[model samples]
Target: MTDSSKWFESLRVSYEQGELNESDITHNPFEQFNLWLQDAINNDVPEPNAMVLSTVNKQGQPSARNVLLKSADENGFIFFSNKTSDKATDLKHNPHCSLLFSWLPQHRQVIVKGKAEEISMQDSNSYFQTRPYGSRISAWVSDQSKVIKNREELEVKVKEFMDKYPENVPMPSHWGGYLVKPESIEFWQGRPSRLHDRIRFTKKANNWTIERISP
Candidate 1:
């Protein structure tokens, strides 16, 4: 095998940054998530809102991509994207999904297994209006996941949209937000000697039950 392959097989990192205890976590997973998220932000973790979203298609093939967490509440975690995108298509075929937030710098991670559903048009419009003008234009430029001939094609579309909506770029019909209503959320903290900490909260019948999970 090549040296690069050997290095990849031998790479290892010790988990000794932190620990999680039952007393340190809130019973409400949302509250606990907020605490960890804020800590990540305060510690200068890059793009702290970025999360890995995993979705499975009708054929049972799973895919994962990084998306920004735009909002979170008692209801669910929200993110926006083109409805026609591959991920969106997978969601339409199968709403069940997973989200993972990795704060390696803080030796923390959060995983959410959930169902996804689109937000209301009004809410999508509200968020779209807050986006940068260039972002709005870019959203209109590409039909995400669709094959294009060249970069010039996207550039042309961007230019066209930029000229069409010079002032306020309206939210495209194909663009909107989805809320991931978590059925279970797990928090993980790295501990010494690979004895990690895991706490999980599961929702059932409008109530949440917290549990300690073996790491």
Candidate 2:
């Protein structure tokens, strides 16, 4: 096993602090999610909003990657990336997706399952313009997920972009955001004896149906 695998295998902490219950949760899943996210922020979990975004290709193969959570509202979670990338291409064929957020230190985890949709161009433009100069330039340089010849070639193109744009870097045509409209969300809280607690909220008609699940 790798170092990381051995590290997990040697974990000794017995989670005994929290438990998920209906009364402890917000009526609205989105609001509850935001609250948990805020806690993650407050506790300074590494990359608090960073989540694993999973998508399925046309051939039914699953792929995933770490992506920053840019925004979240009543509609759902949002993250931005290259529209021409593998994840985006997979999204085009299979719009369904999953976003997993793990707060290991807090013994808490959240999973969101949803359908992906493109945000408005106006929204994309706004977010793009706010990014740093280097990031904006990298967005222009990287084709994302595409095969590259070598590291030198990639850096060469990046350097060219840097030289070309001595001032501000304009947003690339292929970069934008995708919103995940969640149909269901599950929140887990670790407890003693490995008897964890899980609360699930599922979208049914216009309202959400909340239910407790065995953990």
- Whose TM-score is greatest here? 1
What lDDT does model 1 reach? 0.94
Clashes of 2: 0
TM-scores of the models, in the order given: 0.96, 0.94
lDDT of each: 0.94, 0.92
Clash-forming residue pairs, model 1: none
How do the residues 143-177 of candidate 2 rate in per-residue lDDT, one tens digit apiece? 99999999998899889999999888777889999
* Model 1 lDDT, residue 174, Cα: 97
- For lDDT, the strongest prediction is 1
The Cα RMSD in angstroms, rounded to one decimal, for candidate 2 relative to the true structure is 2.2
The backbone clash count of each candidate, in order, is 0, 0
